[model samples]
Target: MENQVFESSEERTFQYQSSLPSLPVPALDESLKKYLDAVKPFLNHKEYQRTEDIVKKFEHGIGKVLHHKLLERAKVKKNWLEEWWLNVAYLDARIPTQIYYNFGGPGPYLEHYWPPKEGTQIERGCIAIWHTLKYWELIRTEKVIVHRYGNMPLDMSQFRMIFCTCKIPGIPRDSLSNYFRTESEGECPSHLIVLCRGRVFAFDAVHEGHILSPPEIFRQLAYIQKRCHNEPDGPGLAALTSGERTQWAEIREYLTNLDPKNLSLLEKIQSSLFVISLDDSSPNGTPEDYTPITKLSLTGDPTIRWGDKSYNCIIFSNGTFGSNCDTFVADLSPCKRLLGQDLTLI
Candidate 1:
């Protein structure tokens, strides 16, 4: 479905949030029956019968109590399992997020006019950045249309993490840092971060109360690229994000303590709208053969990618594009869909 922007006072993107139904807790009996069905293939007749007996016992005893507690929780919370799911599935994982937990894919433009063309990286990247900022504006103004399943509108809260969000590491578990806010809610971060040649640069996407046009963004990107080519590389602090979660957390804390300014710099990256990675490698692969591109996008340059950021747009030297993003923010499908629509804007 095509996304429509609604500028009228009566319509807004998140209008359905309040009216949407809360997530429900399934019955214990239903869950137990599904568990039995799942285990049947793995167990023989005797083993299956013994496992079934244990499951039935639990279903009648502690399972009923836990289910009742969950039902009580659902009564108070809109989505009872959201925080638990995020923690268990993402934040608490100790593996390197870059190649393991994060998701990436080949650029959507590969099937169309934009292909691997050397020296076009900054120019095409500026256009993509401009459209991405426009998408941010649509969300800020509440003009973007709400997504629906049939007549029912789905929750749009996760859209906030699409911009101005980062995942911060901790000792026991990581945490999400989100600075997104609609115009009616409050002010939000409008700065952009560019990662090139192991150096980090920040600039305001909104200048003089308006988002910069493609030409303006191109000037900024071109300047960063040129400086990166001319000068010595800055410390690749971003590579820390590719390490194990607890290790990254300790290193980040050490850096912060080494210099108070380091904490400010970290905040800048965490609060920026999103990251634009200017990659030097060009994985020249067509849409029909995306293996090369996908591999590089997910695992190529640790120095150039902030593995924990909610979104990172990777612009290769040949003008091809790919994205590496933390799954904790949102899944790849919706981001891909949004990028597809953003390309139409371009």
Candidate 2:
């Protein structure tokens, strides 16, 4: 089948959003039946019968009321699961978002380009960043082709949160913050945060309409690297972000009350486009290097990571890179695919 092209802004990407199917609410009896089946393995027949009886009562009574409420919610909101899922699966939970919610993986470029030389990191970072920014521009202009199943265009909402996004911790609950803006919409944040040895720095990555040249970016990175080398190790305060969210919230509040400047700094971290981690150790491996992804992205140096950022790129001293994505569902490879080797299908 020939691919459909959407040129007009409103007619493109999210044009079908209103027509998309609304999220479904499962039937009470059906869900109760599945619940019983799932718990059956852990119970004897008598116990199972007792459990079944309770479920039957609840299904016809309170469960029916709740299910009706859910269906009404589905009618009001096309994607009812978004908030509930995020709360239950992520925000409301106290577990750290690192390994529990986020996943890590290495770049596949090593398969074709091996033997990491000293200068290659800058070259590769330039290529990667340039491609990344271009992808964002496409999304901003509504030019990135939409993905569809049969005739329905899959939702492109999540793509916006991939950049210029971070999670903000609050009392009892945490919230997500997204600052992205299309060129037509408004100005987007064009600065990137660099985290090294628990310290952080920010620099403008965009020069005019283009991303900073490799030489410029390298110079900035080199400057930060030298400063870190000469100075005593930083407090690695970023690690607190990787700890339990509510605990982090308390620490964050203390820091805020401790000083106005500290509150401003926290706001800066939350508002930045994304974070770059200048890691201390280097782990060598093949193109499919899952080890470094684990070490660098999740368990390595917590000091160098901004755990709440939507995307955290960890660049090792050896020039390898791994991504620790705050949101587990996002796949950054599409940014590569939109710029790299042609894709098979949308």
Candidate 3:
């Protein structure tokens, strides 16, 4: 095989998107058979028989109609699962999205160059945020090396959603808000949202056409951390975003009706670039192992997590980092890969 070169990274990255095979709609009978086989462990003989009969009916009757409709829809769309997945797996799910649907992991930084250091959490956090902004810039500029599978480029479309994006709760469904843009595309929001002690603050991450210097980020983060320590606790309204969908919708409605100012506050939260969680817990780990960092990030204070946001950098008091994100795709390697690479940059 000879090495291949490209004039533009975008061309190489998106080369396979149009040629990639479409998502196949499985045959109803085959899928039903697999379902019955999967359920055999949970059901007794008679229960299995009853389920088999029910499955038979579904496969032949209304199930056929539904499958036909799905196939019809697939004929019109390149990927049928896109919208249905958003609806069923995310929007329509009644469970709390943070614990139920979100994916989280500890920063791979501790495993590499930067280890836990007392009193440097904010400093290190700013560094991580800076690298993350750089990663965002890479995505915005189509500079990320194209991921390939067996000589073909995989889809890099979701990179666009990695920053300046959030899920907006609504009645019966939720929608995504993405404000990210490249320099050539147009203006995009360049601010960062800091979450501390249930209160939120905003500051521009991009200062004078560049990501803020580590010192500037340090000052901004220090101010928020100090205010959080001195002031009485905020409403911690972000906790509501972790609630079940319908419950959140109702609570959101009540909140909206309660005060006009609340609506603006919610908008500010849902539209920010990303969230930085200033955690009070000191989840420590040894030099070689960092598993506890991830465990703590997912199980830590619920009030501090904005689960619907695309990214939440959970920074512990000891300068360790873990993260929670509303990534829904099966392949979550992109996030972990990006964060892992960014952890060692500064």
Q: Estimate each model's TM-score.
A: 0.92, 0.84, 0.80
* lDDT (C-alpha) at residue 71 in model 2: 90
All models: lDDT?
Answer: 0.84, 0.72, 0.76
Query: Pick by TM-score: which candidate is best?
Result: 1
Best-first order by lDDT: 1, 3, 2
Model 1 agreement with the true structure over 114-210: per-residue lDDT tens digits: 9789999988999998989998998888877787777777787888889999999998999988899999998899888888888888777887669
Give lDDT tens digits, candidate 3, residues 8-67: 544534446578777899988889989998999999999999999999898889999999
Q: Residue 234 in model 2: shift from native, Å? A: 2.6
Q: Per-residue lDDT for 60-82 in model 2, tens only?
A: 89888898889989988988888
Q: Which of candidates 1 and 3 reaches a greater TM-score?
A: 1
Candidate 3 residue 283 C-alpha distance from true site, Å: 0.4
- Could you give the candidate ranking by TM-score, starting with the highest? 1, 2, 3
Better candidate number, 1 or 3, judged by lDDT: 1
User: Which stretches of model 1 miss by more than 4 angstroms?
Assistant: 1-10, 331-346
